[model samples]
Target: MHQPTVQDFQSLKRILRYVKGTKHHGLPIIPGDSQLCTYTDADWASDTSDRKSITGHFTFMGPNLISWFIKEQVTVAKSSTEAEYRALSAATSETIWLRHLSAKLRLEQNIPTTIYCDNISAIAIAKNPVFHGRTKHIEID
Candidate 1:
């Protein structure tokens, strides 16, 4: 910020224009079933510079999107399955936090939260109780 450039000014103007254009847009939270769910995915090694994966997930309460995020993974994953599993881990943490919040608000969830993932290998790894050699490198925390 000390040495502002022309590109920085142009970027600021572009952001302001986008904000002004979408000022009328709003997120609607429709009241419905209290089923908590999340859909998670990852683009493996999408960043060519660092070879880090991109994690994205959407957490929903019933039909309303309650939480979502897109971020670069802290560690590099060796495969697409690993990337997706990491994203799922993040999403699960978010879902647990939301569940606790809902419980405190007197909206305790009766059913278990569902997590949807596109990667079959990741799903299989999650379902398996034993951590095989393939996944032994992953940190457990």
Candidate 2:
């Protein structure tokens, strides 16, 4: 942040272009129904250099895409399920923040936001916190 690099300049240019292209696009704020939904996924050991996983998620506000991101995980995940769980955790955090922000903005947000993840094993791990043999590594996480 202190020093701008070439990559930063290129990224800024890309953002400017995207903003210009979507200048007319705006999110609709409708009344009566306010719901929060999110989908999360991760690739196990996607980065060969550091063996780190990649986390990606998309958040929606009543069918409209409100937020999304894809980034390298801080720590390497031992299994695909672990990676997916990490992504789901991140999405859940965002969902909570968005819910609070919506309330602050006078939007009627319902409690208990929904988050979808593809990995059944990850879901199982989340559902049952009992540390099993397979999920021992991710227990502390």
Candidate 3:
């Protein structure tokens, strides 16, 4: 921002506090199945300025985290369904990349990796591509 405000400083302080609290936190890779697991979510219209949702996803290889991300949706979502669908799409793309990376490493993952989502409507949209009435607003590309 061109000019920082008190609110911005407060937010910065909060972030620093969180970082301090988690200073010793670490990701642990334990012995487990070689299955890939992914979890995704979206907070519908969470951004006060843009009314856009924040999408987040975390992916795991066996018991270790391999990939994760949090992004603000560029387009404002019309509903929770749309927001969740966007999140799902992002998570799916990341899963594809992880699958390719695993193959390159000769750790060929088993087919049909699991992607978990809390939104039922997003799952439905992903399963039935022909039902475009609810997702017509989303660009095909």
Candidate 4:
């Protein structure tokens, strides 16, 4: 900001205008079922620049969308299943946090949280007790 250029000033002006335009907009939280559920997926090596996978997921408190995340994977995944498993892991973490928070807020989730993942191989890997050599490289917790 020491030597701000015209582009910087224009960008600032545009941001301020957007804020002013959406000042009255707000997210509505309606009362309904309190079950926690999440859906997650990832695209393996989708980024041509760095060849990193993109992880995306969204969580819902009953029928309402409560949380979402979309980001590039820190490490390159060798296979599609690995990439999808990574996304599932991230979503599971988010679900755990939300479950804890809900419990504290008196919205005790009696039912277990369900995480929906599209990749059958990733789901199988997660459920299997025995780990195979192919998934040895993945850091599982």
Candidate 5:
């Protein structure tokens, strides 16, 4: 059921190479940790071709890697404001799913699942949600 094309084959080859490179990576879980925490990390603006950076993230519950995303954004952002907004949106989307997944697994989720981001503006925007000329276009809700 594999797609057949030169680009497809090349992409598969690249994926295989990456897997081969990180074959020994392991998730280290401590002995008796009960907290089911979700981690939303990012690697902004990784794409050199377009100013639209990629956001890389991974969610961990105790020691288990629950969810991850490594996709490039579609739009070209002018400032960190726009990039951080996109990153926040992406992290929030993953956090919602992580919360639902924690519930489904019968884990005791502490209220207010924290979405961690290094960007000060992103954190401010998430907290305030104030309607302003600059923030009116942010699609994160």
Candidate 6:
């Protein structure tokens, strides 16, 4: 692992302090409302660095937050469609893990969970089992 720089240590301390100061910021998840669902979104080409973007996702058990994550895309996207697809895929992988964990804990999701995205093209690509000629480049699993 890389050694932590002074700035890195300061950032970590600041984050810890923020967490300590805002203990009630996070919502409590209740198990019974298994209407669990997840949503993920991203701003494509939002960052200058490597032209990478930011992804934000959240999982909910009814109205309560069960899990959330925000991350940067590793690859630069040639188009917004690709960027959105990548972000949704990343969030999907995480939600799948969360689903399994919830099942193990006896709080298994009872209904089909829908992952909502504002991008219609992304949604179409995801839902369509067959890849058309235009989406042949997309390697969504």
lDDT of 2 at 14: 100
**Candidate 2: which pairs clash?**
none
- Give each model a TM-score: 0.79, 0.73, 0.78, 0.79, 0.67, 0.74
Q: What are the clashing pairs of model 6?
A: none
lDDT of 5 by residue, 75-138 (tens): 7666676676677788778877777776777776776666677777777777777633586665
Model 1 over residues 8-115: C-alpha lDDT tens digits? Answer: 999999999997888778677688988889999999999999999999999888899889999999999999988998998899999999999998788899999999
Mark the 10 consecutive residues where model 3 has the least summed lDDT. Answer: 132-141
- How do these models rank on lDDT, best leading? 4, 1, 3, 2, 6, 5
Candidate 6 per-residue C-alpha lDDT over 1-141 given as tens digits, one digit per residue, 9 for 90 to 100: 158799999999999999889888775545556766888888898998678878888888787887888888777777787777877888789888888888878886777788888888888778774744576566753
Best by lDDT: 4
RMSD of each: 8.8, 7.0, 10.0, 8.2, 7.8, 7.3
How far off is residue 135 in model 4, in Å? 0.8
lDDT of 3 by residue, 1-141 (tens): 459999999999999999789877876668887778999999999999889999999999888887899999888999998999899999999999988888878888877899999999888888888865757887461
Q: What would the per-residue lDDT of candidate 4 be over residues 1-141, giving only the tens digit for each residue? A: 469999999999999999789877756667989999999999999999999999999999988899999999999999998999999999999999999899878999999999999999899888983754578877563
The Cα local distance difference test for each model comes to 0.89, 0.85, 0.88, 0.90, 0.68, 0.79
Cα lDDT, model 1, residue 96:
94
Model 3: what TM-score? Answer: 0.78
Model 1, residue 5: C-alpha shift (Å) = 42
The TM-score between candidate 1 and the true structure equals: 0.79
Over 4 Å off, model 1: 1-24, 139-141
